[model samples]
Target chain A: MNSLEFYVDHLFRKYKASIQIQDLRFEVLGNLEAKVADLTANGVGYDEAVRMAKENLPSIDHLIDGNRTIYINQFRLEYVQITLLYMVIGWIVAMPLQFIRTGFIHWLFLISSAIIGVVYLVLLANRKNINMQKIKAFNLNAVFDLRKQVWLVWFIFIGMSIFITTALQFGSNIWFFRPVDISGPYQFAMIAIKYLIPFASIIVPVIFHIAPKLIMKYEVGENDGYKE
Target chain B: MGDNSISRDIIRGHIDAIILRVLCEGDNYGYEIIKAIAKNSDGKYELKEPSLYTSLKRLETQKLISSYWGDESQGGRRKYYKVTSLGEEAYEKSLADWKIAKDLIDKLIERQD
Candidate 1:
């Protein structure tokens, strides 16, 4: 590789690689080669030509659109970690209430939430070694993967909520050691809706409205390091 | 290079138009486009590589220009840009606008002795 290519590669080494970035790198390298060749033909020494080519490209930040950059900061990851930790704590605290009034499935669901949160925290911690200094261009694949993960989490939570609420209402027929009259699926549906009403009404809305603001609190400005 | 900075700033806003004007002659690649601009301006203005790449990207995104990979006969595969029909229209419009602006600025700045 020429000095120009090596220089460009070194500058781009910190970014997460994607097809778009690869194409851009190739384009830049080819142009720099052409410029260096032109300069050398004009009586500039090979080394000086390469240096001039490098000097001409002061910054590559403009090569990618501002909106597409992924500025990986400590704050975004930490915010997610804290949010997951709070979820685990909340589920564990709610576990005792499950024993008094709810069935075994409800208790299992609560435990599962805590376990999932712990697993997520472990996975997140493992990813902490990434360099937080460099900003990178958007990776479409990563965005799609994250979307799939978010949907999977939502599906799992909602499915568990439905199952636990249904089990709480119909899984047993004993109430305070007395024989309780059992209704059909209609009554079970009513009970499930009753229990889920609080979750759907309150928790979901809170997550939608408040979580974004909370996460935004942790965002380090793009200009953080460059400030005098 | 004292006057170079002010001229560069004045020219920066119309970089897209300038590029489109170059591509209007024929399909061209990055270094060639820079050379063309420098030649046109008698070496007074040299478009920085960063600015040129950014403007080229923006123009491509706007569908004002399209690019293709040239055959690698010249050691490296050059990405050549062509002015689109929309780009030609944009260039014409910008040229007319610049004409009016230039005339007005000259009249305003000219000394009345």
Candidate 2:
């Protein structure tokens, strides 16, 4: 058999997936070449090294290719969580402010907070296309859609936290002018949630995004599950 | 591509045995071992990269075979693997088992005819 035919047959046995034959060829030949390079640098003869590489591989090409499937799944989970977080906060703000006929500042707070959640959702969804192979695209789209809805939830929660803070500030500012008041405990918690939730979620995404990259960097390439 | 039930089952049966036996000869890398199998099988048997790597990982995890970085530089840096004493023992047992299996299957096929 010609070299290409031999290699193609070898690849077909291991990786039966429907990708192009050239892709298969590259994977096999590339890995073989790497081995040849390594053995040559170690003072091994070219023929000896080639022969060595030819004898070693035992039909596991799919491990490397299958990784993309795994990574897409990881992305799916992250966006889903982001979606749920947003949904909860949206309902909170729409509840109280729906009827409150307040001044321009109150409405501004409500409107901007609601819009901010949707904005966060848009940014995430717009960042990537769901054109992943093997991963269901509709499920991926649902993740983004859920994200949009959840952001509304988060925005509402954010608005409540802010509204409470505003109320506290307004209450405290006026308290000094009043006859009396005791509001130390209320001050403590509002400031805490006011500063904490966004930071927590921020760090959460950082950890989420950073993990796979770290794994990739340190990952000595081998059979990583998506070969065939 | 669709249903690989039979192929996967056969490969799984031979995977650990193949890896251990191959490593018994000398240290090797992923692609090279696969190539060797193809050459030995005369193009009749071949392994996919995914299945091979998974078997390699299983062996490595079991401490039967060990892999190290090779200094070879043809296209990419390769991880070289060698069979441990444990792997050698495992290989021998598996070899015996395979012989018995081949005989049984051969007899069954002959009987069918």
**Retained true contacts (fraction), each candidate:** 0.63, 0.39
Q: Name model 2 segments beyond 4 Å from true.
A: A1-30, A34-68, A71-94, A97-228, B1-5, B69-78, B89-113
RMSD of 2: 12.3
lDDT of 2 by residue, A78-156 (tens): 5444544444454453344334332333344456556655665664675565442223112223334555665666667
Among residues 3 or more apart in sequence or in different chains, the pairs in candidate 1 whose N, CA or C atoms overlap within 3 Å are none
Error of 1 at B93 (Å): 1.1
lDDT of 1 by residue, A1-228 (tens): 767878989867756577787878878888889988898999999999988888777557535533233445544565455555555555655565454454443455465567767766665776667666555444344444555666566667777877776567645744345455546986665565457543532223333334344434433343332211
Per-prediction TM-score, chain B alone: 0.94, 0.81
Reference-based TM-score, model 1: 0.62
List where candidate 1 sits over 4 angstroms from the true fold: A8-22, A58-148, A173-228, B1-6, B111-113
Q: Which window of 10 residues has the lowest lDDT sum in candidate 2 chain A?
A: A132-141
Instruction: Find the candidate with the highest lDDT and give its number.
Output: 1
